[model samples]
Target: MPQCREVPSRRRVPSTKITVPGPPADLVSRPRLLTVLDGASEAAMVFVGAPAGFGKTVLLAEWARSRDHEAVAWLSADAEDNDDRLFWSAVLEALGGCGRIPDGNPLRLLAVPDAPSTDLAFLGQVADALDELPEPVVLVLDGAQEITSPHPWQGLRALVRHQPAGLCLAVSSR
Candidate 1:
């Protein structure tokens, strides 16, 4: 039998200054860019795809800081996170960091090294929870190019496509 362990509850951590070197000077004043991107996200999906060193991450980070949203979850994707289970777990934890999980009960459908396929029903529960938010919730997936599998992408695409009205997604990839 699979060992059932509860996923750790995440808490809302105050945003810390992101220290990335050589951020463009002019990029800081572009409020219109953020406004447009935020508007775009409200209407449909917005993907920031660019090669490495294009300032995509910095731009999004700055924009997130400027927003008045209650919570913002940021996950820096690594190579190992390509695994669907690990990726989602990190995402869930990051969401927790943003105070998205209600009542401190985190539903765990995947365990490390188990590679169990994602359960859509559980995802539905998460989506429902996100929809109930009183204010907009922003989830930022940085370094998204690390995700190589189509399955996780498909799941993320579904989530983005069907995201609750109050939930917003911002993805950056090289």
Candidate 2:
């Protein structure tokens, strides 16, 4: 019988790509700025306050592509999601797009009508989920300022102010 050599154990590695596309030539500078912000030790919330043609979304999409061990979620704010409940539901769904939503009841509350009052709870759940992740996540909210409703923005601000170590938020407005 031939003896088999013992193989070394290897650690399970997380995926490095998050499917974020790069920006066009016209929006190059913004990506660089985002890179700088991302590298900081402190948590950051980037508010891209500009008009529609300012290329905020393009820059963020590109910057997200270059990150290592990062997940990206894009939410296109629409009039239908004016309510905090609806907005968060959309946000969570977007996070799902990047494989960020873990399996649990934390998202179950989204089905409830009065979920907005529990915005902090949702934020906590999101933060906890993201904290368990080995990679960082970037959530891009395009047309964020259009939300108009105080509740959604309040929840968003709260999330930004107390973001998990592995999560970051980038909001763009016109």
Candidate 3:
């Protein structure tokens, strides 16, 4: 059995980055929007685009929190994630914490400091692992507009292209 690898410490990833934000105290339940999101659960990818102050974060956070069976790996991207390594590393960390990835999974390899961030083959391996998950996992990338690097985008593209039924990608951006 593969041992669980520790998340790389080369970059000091802020806890807030991987932590799912709670719905705002003043949040109003939007059943209609939540219902729409629930209806789209089968989609491989869901994009929520809106301008600032449009409650994009609140909606995504609420949706993530309400999931009873599906695990949600939330990442609030920031400008520092422009570096491909940092971006992918944070993603791996988030997924690792989602409690859905089985032990000794290939996805953990990307958390190593020396792992290739933009390697399509390696990303395909990660996708394969996600494909075998017994339960669904939704990876929500809030504030995704901060990720401007093409390399990370390429890596993301690979993951999405090979996305399996067990994995769902949710992204919110301005």
Candidate 4:
């Protein structure tokens, strides 16, 4: 009889991506900046890249505030959560958070082998869900500069390219 060696167990820890931070209570409103963002809504991608203390969060939060009628999903990613699996996990979480993606949805079907085709299929499911919505959905990947890998960038590109109508991809990086 052959003896089997004991295999070590691996625990799946959830990603620590923070919730989108809110603007200060006393922060002043900027109507002009809001107007610019409203105008940019016609474009597919709205990227805000600037140095620290550039009011990126405040601006996005303001836009979110003004556009309360829209479906918005905000995700605050950190440097530590910069992996392919974690990146998609966070995206799913954020989308689910906004009620954009339903609970226990195509995410389960998307768990099949991680290939370009699977990745695309998963994104397609997301796009289909967004397409069914009566209002436009704005998915904000805030603090995205922390992720330096090309995988997330590629996925983001594919998502933006194939996103459903009335969906926007807003990336805020520093």
Candidate 5:
């Protein structure tokens, strides 16, 4: 390894921080729920919508862990992730967790001032990048209800529409 001669300039970055939800320590395996959730694997989109304390998160967590062959990326949404750029920024980061999407940091690309602001065009690029993953990936966007604005969701919808063969989307929201 070589040491850097000079510290390169760092550009402005988005706060796309995310944490993949893990199954509870005392996870109660519900064969019934897992059976139903299994259907999501074949479909492009699966949404777990219900009020709080309905076990939606846990259910999704279990679904993600059930399979050994599939890659899983989790984005635990927060109040600040509502922005179009921030949302996709976090999504790309999560998807990169599967050891695909190469070694570059996605936020650096998204944060570039000249990048397109439209959700469709920008998110399309995101989808294209995700499609390059070595294996099919199941992306879990937890706490999706945190996003109040409708503008960013257009990007999410676009993702599902352009969803590649190796990608599946699972959203758990209140």
Candidate 6:
């Protein structure tokens, strides 16, 4: 068996990357948009796509704060996480660290420092576990445009195709 490489933790992921950021000080509340987001809670995925300076981040932050913090897991993607393992690791950490999933969830297996490569089967298992959850959990991936690589995207595509009722994926991209 090919040994799995240890995931480096030397570069600390910023807290803001995994935590829901507060809305900007000058944010103009958009009740119409927020209402749309409220209605999208039941959707398997919510996509916010626009050019730069469109306030996608501000709007998403606002909507995320409106919900129970425990129900939301946030990840701000950047150029650094363009790799498959790094991106999946961040996703696992974001979902696992959130207080929503109970301890010892199978999802935690991939979050460890020396876990094997994340493949389609693991993501499918993740979907199955999510389907069994009693409550809903929203995973917000912000700045998804930074991931130019197709490898991570293929995995995410698999996840989306097999998304569970309890998992609502929200993505923002330029």
Best TM-score among the predictions, by candidate number: 3
Measured against the true structure, the TM-scores of the candidates, in listed sequence, are: 0.73, 0.68, 0.87, 0.76, 0.75, 0.86
lDDT of 3 at 139: 90
Give one digit per residue, the lDDT tens place, for model 4 in 16-101.
34245567977888889889888887677888888988888888877876776236777776764456666676666666556544
List RMSD in Å for every model shown.
5.0, 12.5, 4.4, 5.4, 6.1, 3.5
Candidate 3 lDDT tens digits, 34-125: 99999887899999999999999899989988986339888999888878778877887888878888778766545434444566566776
Cα lDDT of model 6 by residue, 18-111, tens digit: 9888767787999999999989979999999999999998889899898888888899999978766677777877887777787867765544
List ranges where model 3 is wrong by over 4 Å: 1-10, 112-117
Per-residue error for 9 in candidate 1, Å, reads 9.8
Cα lDDT computed for each candidate against the true fold = 0.64, 0.61, 0.81, 0.67, 0.67, 0.79
Expressed as tens digits, the lDDT of each residue in 1-174 for candidate 1 is 999977533332223311222346666556777887778767435678889987788878777677653366677776766667667667666666565445543332223233323556656666666776666667777888887887678777676667677577878898
Give model 1's TM-score versus the native structure: 0.73
Error of 5 at 129 (Å): 2.4
Q: In candidate 6, what residue range of length 10 has the lowest lDDT sum?
A: 110-119
Q: Residue-wise lDDT of candidate 5 within 52-99, one digit each (tens)?
A: 998888888777777652377777787876665566656765665554
Lowest lDDT 10-mer window, candidate 5? 7-16
Who is ahead in TM-score, 5 or 6?
Answer: 6
Which candidate leads in lDDT? 3
Off by over 4 Å in 2: 1-31, 37-42, 68-70, 100-113, 117-119
Candidate 4 deviant stretches above 4 angstroms: 1-18, 100-118
Count of clashes in candidate 6:
0
Lowest-scoring 10 consecutive residues by lDDT in candidate 3? 108-117
Q: What is the lDDT of residue 15 in candidate 4?
A: 34
Which scores greater on TM-score, model 2 or model 4?
4
Q: Please give the lDDT score at residue 128 for candidate 6.
A: 81
The per-residue C-alpha lDDT of model 4 at residue 123 equals 67
Scored against the true structure, residue 165 in model 4 reaches a CA lDDT of 72
Total backbone clashes of model 1?
A: 0
